[model samples]
Target: MTDDTNCIEVVTLTPLAQRFSYRCRTPLPEPGCRVHVPFGRGERIAIVTGSSPCPEGVQIKDVRTVLDQQPLLPKALQALLEFGSNYYHYPLGGAWATALPARLCQGEPLPTPKPELWKLRSDATLPQSGWGLRQSELLQRLRRGNLRMTELGSGDRQRIRQFLAAGWIEAARESPRLHETPLTLRPEQQQAVAAIRAACGFQPFLLDGVTSSGKTEVYLQSMEPLLLAGKQVLLLVPEIALIGQTYERCVQRFGATAVAVYHSGQGDAERLRVWERARSGSLSILLGTRSALFVPLARPGLLIVDEEHDPSYKQQSGWLYSARDLGLRRAQLEELPIVLASATPALESLYNRQCGRYADLRLRERASAQNIPQIEILPLRKKRLLGGLDPSLLSACAETLASGQQALFFLNRRGYAPALLCHDCGHVPHCRRCSAPLTWHRRQARLRCHHCGWEAPVPQRCPSCGGDGMNGIGMGTEGLEQFLQERFPNIPILRVDRDEVHTPRQLAERLQAIRSTRPAILLGTQMLSKGHHFPDVTLVGIVDVDQGLYSADFRAGERLAQTVIQVAGRSGRGDAPGRVLLQSHLPEHPLLLALQSGDYGTAAAQLLRERQQAGLPPLRALALLQAEAQRVEPVYAFLHAAQEYFQGSLDCSGPVPALLERRAGFHRAYLWLESTSRPLLQQVLGASMPQIPSLPGARRVRWSLDVDPQNF
Candidate 1:
């Protein structure tokens, strides 16, 4: 017990930015190790962030017990977390705490990785000749050698369990068996891979390729050399649904032990295994969504963000950090090459490319030289819509179906309808907990608020008019599927959305069904738009294109353009040339025109120039000071004081209400801050962190500072 290691600074996985001091006895736990320490009334297993000698006049409690034998977070990961904490203006404790699995924080011992091997046990009796073929086959498979658990399916599991129960088998763990799938790359893909390999350090490359341009192939090809070196690669996608195909592909190419998945969808034990694998450098690739960026790697070689522009990459709640942005910084810190591949790049990334911050690698030609989808703009002026589908677009879908080809109807909204309207009084149903209308889910027979997730049973009569003439006003994907079913009667229509597919297996089954069914009509929301290749689909019909044209948010047009191109890109991947029919009320809309001509680059360029002239992002930096309360006045008062706190230091916009002003029973408002310089804006926010929470009405509301806000 050295006097020099007498006290320690602890950081809990909580919102408090303040670090706590605790006395330590004997050998102190190193930084990044976990310790169970007394918090307010109970105990919390906190991370040891720093340590020093005991203060002269302080009385502090000692750390109860060390929870880890070695450091939980690597040095590089700790440094990256520090940078993220300062940059996002978030509490390091919260980010650091959330980085560990929930079980680890709950004082549960870290779970050990289970050996995936099973074999026949010694001294076990052999089955007699009366064994069934299924039992015989299982025994024969294990007789040859111990089989990896990943090599068997769910049905095979029962057989293996029966064998184990009969004292015929035992489990074992060993080094991960290595395997590699051979592949031939196209000329352009080869060049992209070579360029990435030749990079010196901290080089950012934008794989600005079109959808179905073999970007994944290029990513995999580039990783081949690094995987052979036993170095780890970080692959980030936008959503959990997208992880299935990518994970399967990675595991198939490099064996099951070589790949580990990190995402919120997995259970605690599963996530812990991946965390252990990542930290131990046993994983060749750590694949996941936004939160996986915090996972420490033993030997990181490359970072790849597929669909970098997708808004899902931005964390919305506690830490409003961008995985793509952090990946760039992480690569710089680690001196590794990174790739940001997207069909429609974000305006910020594009601006970075324009400024030469990122090398623009454009793979113009599709791998197989498949023809680009032909786009047609169908005007909806004076034309009646049946479930939001234009007559011309409907006819095109029917023709494609008759020709034994698939048809995809891309509509970004779910549920049966947007609102339940009363014919008598022109009244609409609204949510009590939110300042928004409740969408009608026909299957559930309920009105659901998309903003706050509050649900209500469908009323037999309109509340306002006390009339039974309640009608659904706007059609959604659910209603579209129902309508298409009635129209076709003979063909199958499958709807894909958050409501339909809640699991990876469900989504995989839906996709597999779509592949097997020809002349089928597929209806869905944005879930079907990103990173999906349906080669059999020869036609695409986009409904409700006007919804994004009049959005209050500035980035709506940019997002719409990206989605339009991505949805259109889903077609024409097969041998036959495909076409996309877009139904729009404003036929001449610039974004529509860009999509009609199949050129998103022009739209992105124009949007960037518009942002520059308007003193918005990519030109002038911005941060949002958001506060919400159960009562409205406290929110406005707190924001007004915050605006005053930054009066001359930075320019402040209104203590205005949010787009959806009141959500989940909280009245929200924000003060918009802008600056020509990024550093100055960040400095202003950092300076105000202490004062904003101490404002007169601060304790009455929930508040946060969103740096580089993606939403309005």
Candidate 2:
């Protein structure tokens, strides 16, 4: 007989078929608690998912240890994980692993943040002679008022400890001070704020605003009511690079102690501390990147997704899931309101608004009173160009710089050039691992593969023909930077790309330089386009646009449109009027002409109609069964067999070669399953989870199921 009450279900941080049942002690631990249990030949840290009956005729081992006094994850977060696991067709173990920090997964105890405040003693005698430089500075600062330990420097820590022991200082537990000063909102912004504040439960609002249209201000003002009610708010950004800027803004509005920032860039200890503080309800406002969606909240009230249209929210690798989609699910589970704010809203979000599933909040005008940037298409046909720079565009840049304003050259490519071409044999270098060209990085004096991250020193002679005639072929950010620097020697040139900005600190420093330096030239890739406000940048010259106009991927047009509008929006954010020049070989392209009208709604509607006619996403559901291996045969064999096995109500496409046939030395192929009904698609995909793994040649190759895949 199965003992249902004494058995608990646990899941480890591995790709397993299902949860395992383990016999629990008399005092049962909660579902979200961590448990140490024995697996096949090893011990693993597993999460207690729920209670289950002991399987008949199975040897169930007893759990060795319960790591938490209370559930580590709250019930709301647990529900979100469960929904994501089933929706994305991912295992619970992998979902848990992706959601929590690495330290927590390794059985580390929850971090308790005990902040100490230090102040000078009232009756302490002066320490003039014996103290070192740091000690003297610390005492001098403490004479003013109390300071948090975090405010002290590393060298001052030892001196503070000594001073505490010597009765020269006193310490107490620190408390957060809430000093929220809400910005004065315009009428439209006030309307948006009111809509968010009036949300009773599980409401979704799409805050559709143009760049610099005060969407963030709406977020800040709406959060005030919730924060005052002693409820925590979660704000999810799309990038780690934006966390520093967003964190600074939040800290400035709500006191430093009230706001906390969490991301993967921080150390494990810091991440765990933030996680614990958030769960303990000590944090009022928590800001983070995509993964922060899983952070537990003791008193959840509202969820905000900034730049909701960004592709970064979709996890491209293991355990594929959409943070934005799951954010909505989390809000529903928590019975809270979620605001998805974006300038160029995602088509899915727009569709939802059209279907009346989401409330629409629009901020039509720029908050700064600056006019929308003027868009002009510069025809790149039969014009004398200087190293890919049209003379007219160069003149415009010079004019902007000469007028004491900044000009930006926006190119979505990085490195020096696309490939190193040999003149003697007309040979181009390609990545040894991927079937892609090697990019030439001039400053590094190396050839790099953007796809696989492989690099090699620039060769003196062509590998195909022993001739010394290799040169870069196409223009990239580095090449454009060099070309502009040579032409405008007097102006300061700043390049913002992955190569130049590796960390958030570096990106912050570069942004600071752009703000402080006038009459500067900024050159960068798409990293520069994500809601960065460059006030003095009056001119934006799009150096490249044709590459993205036509692609095998259906989302290419939408992505290109978003990029163009976002890059153009960076201009005219300051006092001066702004202008954008798009250099395109095909100026009459319908997409460009639609962008020229500056009506994204109309363009999006047209695209939606086309999608409806074509039976794409937001109209129909899609699930991609991806298979890859070092060899081609196994991948095709496994996918073909699985395709045959899955043949049923849903329409099944070919197990065709992937967009990139070979990447990182793996031969990739995919099968697309589509249905008009989402529930039906989910049903079909959910059924294949276990059966497909046992398909022919499945063990010889790696395979995964991507539900609502963003990439092909």
Using all chains and alpha carbons, the TM-scores for the candidates as numbered come to: 0.91, 0.92
Predicted structure with the largest lDDT when compared to the true one: 2
TM-score: which candidate is best?
A: 2
Candidate 1 ranges with C-alpha deviation above 4 Å: 1-4, 113-182
lDDT of 2 by residue, 1-712 (tens): 6677899999998768578999988578998899999988999999988888898988789999989889878788888888899999888899999999889899988876564578777888776698777777787789878888877778788888888889988765334444655778889998999889999999999999988898877888888878877889999999988787778777877778789898889999888889988887878899999899999988898999999999999999888999999999999988999999998999999999999999999988997778777689999999888979889999999899999999999999998898999999999988888888899999999999998898999998999999999989989999998999899999999999999999988999999999899989999998888778888989999998998888888888888888988899898898899899999999998889888855577678877887899999989999899998999999999988877887886889989999888889999999888999999989877877778768899999988889988887
The sequence of per-residue lDDT tens digits that candidate 1 reaches over residues 1-712 is 4354578888887878888889887577888888889888998878888886766666678788888877888777788888889998899988886677877777787667565679888788895778997788888898898898888989888888888888888876443333665567778888899999888778999999987888988888788878877778999999998998888778777777778889998998788888887876657789999889888888889999999999998889987888999989889888999999999999999999999999979877776557667579889899888767788888888899999999999989888999999999999989998898999999999999999899999999989879999989888888888899899999998889988998988999998898899989988989999898788888988887798998989899898999999999988888878899888889998778767767778889888888988888978898898999999998988888888878999989989899999899999888998999999988877777877768888898899889888987
C-alpha lDDT of residue 707 in model 2: 92
Error of 2 at 404 (Å): 0.8
Instruction: Pick out the ten consecutive residues of candidate 1 with the lowest summed lDDT.
Output: 173-182
Q: Count clashing residue pairs in model 1.
A: 0
Q: Model 2 clash pairs?
A: none
